[model samples]
Every structure is written in C-alpha cells, then in structure tokens.
Target chain A: MHIPNGFLDAKTIAVTSAASAGILTVSLKKTKAYLEDKQIPLISVVAAFVFAAQMLNFPIAAGTSGHFLGAVFAAILLGPWEAFLVMTLVLSIQCFVFQDGGLTALGANIFNMGVVGVFAGFLIYFFLRRLKIKLSISAFIASWASVVMAAGITALELAISGTTPLIQSLTAMVSFHCLIGLGEGFITVAALSVIFMARPDLLKEKAFSKKITGLVAGLLITAFFAALVLSPFASSLPDGLEKVAHNLGFISKEAPSNFSVISDYQFPWVKNKSLATSIAAGVGVLAVLAVGSGFFLVLRGREDGA
Target chain B: MGHSYFDRYRQVDSFFHRLDPRAKLLWMFFFILVVVLTPAQAYTAFLLYLLAVFVLIRLAKIPLKVVFKQSLIIVAMVLMVAFFSIFKGSLEQKLLLIFNVTAKAWLCLLASILLTASTPFELLLKGAQSLRVPQVLITLLSFTYRFLFLISEEVSRMQKARKLRDFGNSRLKHLKTIGHIAGNLFVRSYERGERVYQAMLLRAFKGEINTYSDLRFMQTDVGFILITTGIMLPIFIFSILFTTQY
Candidate 1:
C-alpha cells in the first residue's frame, strides 16, 4: 500500500505531496487544542498498540495473512483528526526507521493510508452510527464500509498517478477489499464487543446499548465460521491494485526492484512461493508485535514507576 | 521505551542535518523530478541518477544496509507488479521498462530517505507549516504520528492476554480469540480518545492550532540548496532534452 517514490511520476508526487502536506498540517493544528501533557503517555501507548496489532496479521485464508488497517480503530478512538495524525506518525516511523514505506512517496502513503483511510473510515462509521443500526451491527457495517472505501480511494490515487487505468484499479482494489472488508468487519465487531463486555463505560457513546450483545455474538459466530471456511481462498486471486497495474502499462514499465534478494520468493532453498511469503509474513507480524509491545511496556513501566 | 523514530538523528549535529527542512524538501523535490522525468529506457541517465544517489547516501552516512532494506520493500512491490511482464512483454522492452521503474524508484526512495534522515520529523512538520501547508493537514499528521505506536502496543497486550488464556488451541478458537482481542482494543482506544478530547477542551483549544515552532533559514540551508541545485539542474535539463522511451 506504500507507493514508493519512483513508481509515480514527478507531477503525481509533487501534487500529492503538496496536497498531503496541506491536509497533514490541518490535522496537526486541529489536534493541538485537544493536547494535554497527561494524555501523552496514553496516546503513545495506544499508538504502539495500533502498530503492534497491525503486525499480527491473522491468517485470513489457507495461504494469506491480513493485518489490521487501524483506521476505524484510530478514528473511533481518537476522533477523525487525531486518528489521521497518529497514522501519519506510524507511517513515518515505518518508512524512516523500519524502512517499511517509501520516503519520497511518504506524502502519497500518508494521504492514502493515513488521511484517506482514517478519515473515510471515521466518517462512514459516524454516519452508520447515526442510522440507528444495532451498535455492534453498525460497527460491523461502519468498519467494513470504511476500509472498503479507503481501498477504493487508494485505487483512485494509483490511477491519478498514472500507474493504471481508473476502472481497472478500482475493480482490483474493490475486489480484494471485498475479502479484506470481511476480516475488517469481524475484527472491529470482535474488539468492540469485548470492550462492551469488559468495561461498557469506556464506549463513550450514549448510544452504546447493552441489548445488542446477542446480535454482536451472533455476528462474531457467523464471521468466525466464514473466516474459517474462507481461509483457503484468500490468495486465490491477484489483489486489486496489482490487477490494475497489469491492465495499465505500469507493470510492464516497472524495473526489477534493486533489493530483491530472492526473486518472487522462488529461491532454490525455498521452492514454494507460498511457503516463502507466509514465512516472511509471519516473521513480519512477530517482529512488529515484539518490538511494539516490548517498547511500550518499557515506556509505560518507566512512567508508572516514576 | 525508545519511541522516537522519525527524529532519531535530529539532535545529532551534522553538516547535512542542520539545513532548513524546507530547503532540504526543495532539494528532494528537484532530485525526484530529475529521477522520474528521465524515461525508464534511459539506462545511462538512470545509471547517472543511481550514482548521484549513491554519492549522496555515502556523504550522508546512512547505512547502506538500511537503505537497501528500505529499498527492498519497494523492490518487492515493483517485482510483484512486473512479475507477469517478465514473461509477457518483449524481452528488451520488459528489461528496459523494469530497469526504468526499479532504478527510478530506488533513486527516488534514496532522495526522500536522505531528507528524513537529515531532518527531524517535527521540524519537517514545522517546515510544511511555514510553507503555508494547511493547519488541518498538519493536525491530522501530528495525531497520526503521535498515537500510531500507542494503539499498536495496546493491541499487542490484548493479544497476549488472549494467547495466555487460550494457549495455542484450535485454529477456529484462535481466530475467534483474535477477533475478540481486536474488539476490546478498539473499544479501549475509542474511550481513550474521548478522554483525550476532554483534556484538549480543558486546554482551551480553538479551531486553529499554534505551536512553539522555530525555523531558521541559515547559511548552511542556502549552501545545501545551492549545491543540490548545481548537481540536479543539468540532469533535469538533459532528461528533458533527450527524452528516451522505455
């Protein structure tokens, strides 16, 4: 999802960069009035929590693992503006420290994942909540809707960058996200439900009624079965962005990334691409969780002990 | 406990690190322009761009391994994109096109990495602000960066608690457990946000945000800008003049 620097044209990068900067600045400024010195510790703690959660990609199908988008989680938790800021920081650290995203393309990434993903998801969640759906069902719908929309917007960004045609990109993004949305919906509902069970007061919304626990439980059971059944087909099709790239000329135009140690995970030692990708994905999850959890515990311990 | 990543090297004194972020930003913009404008088929020009990036990376003292690792993520994506092209396109055309993309992408990544490596992210934010970037955007980014990791940690704890209780049971059970963990984390974060907002309200926040940001356009910033332009301008001119198709 992190569009690296050279994959896009200069005009694309410049315009997006400028626009992203504008949006990011507004987000930052809007957060200031809400900032209190005491909240810093809590904010930092949750940010790390989001980061770690993203790392633990649950196996969605037989061969594929999907990570959390955190947009809904961030927005619902932090408010729309604040969520954008937290996500941007995650992306920056991911790029600079961990080398996860592109530096030159940071603006585009933040725009896609941070700004578009967070805000779109938040707004959708907001509207869905207003529609008077069951709280759990509303969360499920809102969370699913947000990620799907974000994915569509990302495809649009790719098209605007001239990497692929709009329809192809849109089709590809939307199709894959259809699957991702399931996982997203389940995660959102599950997380919210447990919190509803454990500390109902923390929901902060007056509308968070307890009557919907049965509905939430029913949804979770259904999603769990759906996930279990769908696991085999997760990687059956090419993702939306990739499909669009192929249909457009960008796939042909792409150079072999200079850093490929193993081409297509087809190394002689690891003959199976599936095995190789899964291993790498698993490693990434563990790495992110370990680093994030360890770091936060240390930080929190220090603050509490002080 | 080590939370800072974007600004890790900011406080470190260096010739390159002290340049104004806006100046550094301009340099990055121009550098990316030259790299991207060069047609993917322009192998010689691509080589030149790569060489230029190599020199800059060396000068900046960014670890080769680190840059390479970062580049690898993009390379993986590019490879995935070009995977079919390898089999489908004309051999030379595919090669040239792939080379153009991979080379240009790598070079551009290098340029941006250098910018971040040399400047603190907070200062980078301030630079954007001074450049008249919208306050809304900055506010969004500020909160994103600020809380990204915190939420990540909370999710981890919930997962740990789930795992400890479940102890690597059936796959279905594990999936359900994971889902529950995610739900709890979301609820916790949502509540924390309400508290944070209340805290903010107590601070008397207006719609607009003000920061104690200080930006100085020093001689070093000017020098850095001049040197970058001196190196990049010719390449940009040449790439435009002798445009090659890949």
Candidate 2:
C-alpha cells in the first residue's frame, strides 16, 4: 500500500527512509558494473512499459477490475536489480508527479512495494524453480506471496507507528490482501505463460546459480517460521515491551505529546465503534470512486476537445 | 495522447510557472519537510501552511478543479486511515488522528500538485539533474516520461481490439485474454526498446544522457526563497511556542 503523509510517525519514516536509501545505493552500484551502454535505453523503455502496464485494468469479477503490480513479472523478465530500479522510478514518479503517494512516506512506500516486493518475489520464484515447479505456477506463487508479505510489512509499520493495534491491523491487512494476491497470482501466471511460450530466452538469461538459490530458499524458510513464532508474542504485550525498553533507558518515556491536540487518547466517542467505522469506510470508498471517475470524465472530455 | 495527463497545466503562464524549476522544486521540498515535521497538534501552523499553499496555487493560475481532482487520491487514502482510527482510541483521539492526518496529507499533496502543475516535466527532470540526483535514476525517469503515453496508447488499442472480438462472459476466459494482451504488450515493448537502442547507437549515443537546457537561477528565484522563508519562520516559531505550552 502507498502510505500517505501523517500515517507514519517520525521514527518509522526515518528508519524506512534510511533503509531504502541504502538498498537503492547498493542497487545502483551493483547495476553499474555489468549494465552495458546498450541496455540503458532498454531499461528506461522497460520501466515505461511497466508503468503503462499498471494502467491496463483486467476484469476480475462482476463490476470489479484489477491490474498487475508487475514487481514479480518485472523481476522475472528483467533481473531483480533492474526490477528494483524500475519500481523505484515508478513509485517516485507516482509520488512527485501524481501525488498518488506521500513525499514524506515515499521511503516506506518504496521499501514495501519496490524492495520487498521485488526481492521476495524473486527469491520465491528462485526457490520454486529449484524445486522443479512449473515456471507459470512458480510465478503465480511468487507474486501472490510477494503481495501478502508486502501487506504484512505495511501493517507492521502502521502498528509500530501506533496508528492501530498490532493484531487488528495485521489481520485486517493480511486478510484483505489475500484476495488481492489471488488476482496478482492469476495475472502473473497468465503473463508468464505467454512469455514462456514466445520468448523463453529472456527468462533463461536471468537464472541464478543452484547454490545461491538453495541458500536463499533456506534463509526465506527460516525467516518465515521465525515471524510466525514471534508475531503472537510481539502482538500480545507491545506496551509492556515499550515500558521495559523505556525503563532500561533504551527509549524515551514521553508519550506522543503531539497527540495531545485531540484531548483524550482513549475511548470511542460513539457506543457502536464498529458500526461507525464501517459507515465511515463505506462513505470514504464511495466518495473516492465518485471523485475519481468524475475526474476521468473531465479528462476524457478534454481529450475529445483536443 | 491529446490530454497529456502528466503535464496538464504546465503551459499556463503565471508567476509559479515562470519561476525557475529549481526554485519551485525547493519550495516543494521545504514545504513538505516543514509540514511533516510540524507537530500534528499545531492546528494554527497547519492552517497557515494551507494558506501558503492556497496562495501558491492561486499564483500558479491553475484551475482549482484540476488541483482538487488530482488531490482526491491522497484524500481518499487519508480517509481510509481515519476510518481505521475510529475503531481504536477515545473519541477525542480518533478525531485528533483524523484531523491531524487529513490536514498534513492534504497540505503535502497540494504542495506537490502545485509543483507538477506549474513546471513542465522536462524542466523538472532538468532541475533534478541540477540538484545532483543520481544520473542513472534521472535517465530512467526521463525515458519513462517520454515513452509512457505511447505505451498507454498501445495498451488502449489492444483493449479496444479485445472488446471488439470478445463475447465471453466467463471470468476465467476474460483473464486469459488479458494475460495474452499483457504478454503481447511486453513483447512489443521489448522489441521497441531494442529498436530505440539501435537508433540511439546510430546517433553516437554513449552511456551518458546529455541535456541541452541551461538552467540558471535568477534574482527572483532568491527573492522567492527569501519571501517563503520569511513566512515560514514565524509559523515555525508559533508552532514551537504553542506546542511547548501544552
């Protein structure tokens, strides 16, 4: 998800920003070593292709449509580093030009959607291929897992920022993304099948060494199970952990003083909090769809006039 | 192609449009940094920031409708977060969360929209180059911008052709067709990339992308920055004073 400004606190933003900057710097240097002059224009063109492809919506169900995120597909087509750069460019343009994502939160957005999405997807694909899974099936699984993992990370960020309770945000983000991931999987499979049929050479060039693939797969499995084990404990007593950290002089004792503007930081104004929230969500979805479609209508009108 | 969605209002002649692209870029970065760093509780400061953005929007002479429409995506996102906040803290806290998030996001979005709406995309890229953003990144961005519309047109053309022959109501069938289109688009794009590389090579292309635009900061650019700083300093002072007392 593209986190807007104000969604994350300063600490989360700073950490993510530094992390993304580091990864991008490393990617730039690594890409420079083997990236031939002939491939320069190709890289730009490929990035534009991804940007355009994202705008191409496919019908998923009645009255609904979805588009490919292209991270997994890009990584499979290009190398992972190239996909990372393409994603970074796309996200940056979306933030700066379209205001689709927040400037302050750009680091988090890029890290979640670009770095995590690309690397996780690539790693999963690599693992599956090593296991002799079909290319189409592996692409599907990798893209699906990538979407879900990115959503989980996004929820973790929100929880760390104290925007919502950890368990609830985690569950909500993961559940909703599960459906989105299915669509992603389908699209990735469909696209990969076609490419495999037509130009298998592109995929061949990007293959990893068997030793490296096995190592990555082992690391991924370990990390996945570790997260599974740690999540419940982390969610149960976040406040307790914070308190302990504060007492140990690791963190400041200050409660978010800036939040004092709201007067009270606990308790709902309405008796039926769930109902109120659902209504608000409905209203927001409707308003956004209406405004978005209206804007497109105006744009179309201008296009016709021109 | 006719709409030029990326630079819809860049041709407009106004103070903001006339300002050096670097100046506008600086204004955008400074405004966003200030807005983000301001404590969420600083309502007065936020209001002042909003006022400043509104003034800039006016000076840019861009249509309010265009700006608001462009901003709706950010508004929608913030609203979703606010909705979640309702299920969490006290009534006051929920309200505060919504207010703080909405104000900060809206201000930042407006500042960004102003920059893009007023400055042409090419100039913005040039400004970014002058700012010494990595050369490789800028090259990717410039190429993406140049080819974005063409690829979009190609996708639309494919979609139109699909609709013409498609009689299938089945979801799976539709997905299959979309997948094929996506595959075809990718292949076409790859081919186009190769042809473009060859063309660039014929023109004595090197790894370096050269731009001919010579961007120079003028007297007014300095004056504009000074004026913005003059306004921002007081807001910063007021926010600090207001926050500390509470």
For each candidate, what TM-score against the reference?
0.66, 0.84
lDDT of 2 at A1: 77
| Model 2 chain B worst lDDT window (10 residues) | B85-94
Docking class of 2: acceptable
Candidate 1: where are CA atoms >4 Å away?
Answer: A10-52, A75-100, A103-111, A114-132, A156-173, A198-306, B1-13, B84-89, B132-172, B186-215
Position A161, candidate 2: lDDT: 62
Candidate 2 Cα misplacement greater than 4 A, ranges = A58-65, A205-207, A210-233, A237-306, B1-3, B244-246
Whole-model lDDT, model 1: 0.60
Instruction: Estimate, for each residue in B1-246, the C-alpha lDDT of model 1 and write its tens digit.
Output: 235654565565666676788887777767876676666655666777778778877766677676676556676667644753443334565565466567877787777777777676677788888988666545545665666667666656666676678875865566557777766665566567658766776887543468886788998888888877887777666765575332
Kindly provide the TM-score of model 1 when superposed on the true structure, using C-alpha atoms.
0.66
Clashing pairs for predicted structure model 2, backbone only: A266-B90, A267-B90
Clash totals for all candidate models: 69, 2
Give interface RMSD for all predictions: 8.2, 5.6
Tens digits of per-residue lDDT for model 2, B196-216: 889988998776788797888
